[model samples]
Target: MAKQKIVRVDYRLIHGQVVAKWIKYHPVKRIIVADDELKNDEFMCDIYKLAAPGNEVDIISIAELEETLNKKDDDVMIIFKDIKNAKLALNSGVKLIELNVGAVQNGKDSYFVTSGVALSKEEFKDLQEMQEKGLDIYVQPIPENEKLSLESIKNKIK
Candidate 1:
């Protein structure tokens, strides 16, 4: 198995949007879900499994992420349900991967992740850390909605 190159954070997990967009956009072969809730939730994992066709999608723990996939230089897209786990995953060997913020609706107003998806205080801090680490973080829609252009995102980053 090869290493994953892209890491996405979507509260919704695998669904129609992800299957149709990122699976093809990044040409991803493996989908790794780094949500502890989903990692322990078998039923949720099953639901995610059904969404993906031929691709291998594993909902694993933040701990298992590195050992399972030693590198991040291949065709893989990692999805985390929250920023904390996403940062922990980054603490592993992951680097310079494109962060697609899928959804974080439950976050507080102070937490900035685009104009839409909310973020918790901790989540915001984690994102700041990830930024400090030099990860490429961007808020892109699930393809059904209007695309979020680089110019627009640059404003949010400022």
Candidate 2:
């Protein structure tokens, strides 16, 4: 792989922060979405592609992504729709040094995780597993704002 860009877990695949800031600010050449769900969903796939106009977005399944190994630049960002899917990709030999916990949705027994993001018990469990594997997980919505580091965010769990 030329580079192993960011591995972010976001329910919403593409957003303004992703296109405007992460892609433009950091200047990533490609946006790789490694999610099996989105890979199969035609509507979501179309949405992601259309949402990122003038941006190179590759939506690939975990199996397909594992066989590939080339980011071609330092600015590429690898994103996943959920933590579980991203975990699968990472275990498949994708080196993700930094992980961005983009957002979590509201649900029963869930608590406020970060700005506009909440986590249910099941989601929290997946997050704990990622932390155990030593991935730097943070809850940050916008790139420009101050971010919540892994240590700081983890402290809020227990």
Best candidate, TM-score: 2
Instruction: Write model 1 residue lDDT over 30-78, tens digit each, in one string.
Output: 8888776778888878988989998888778888887557644457778
Extract clashing residue pairs from model 2: 28-75
Per-prediction count of colliding residue pairs?
1, 1
Per-candidate TM-scores read 0.78, 0.83
Off by over 4 Å in 1: 1-3, 71-74, 108-116, 143-158
Steric clash pairs (candidate 1): 107-119
- Cα lDDT tens digits, model 2, 21-45, are 7775556667888877678989888
How many pairs of residues in model 1 come into backbone collision? 1
> In angstroms, how far off is 51's CA in candidate 1?
1.1
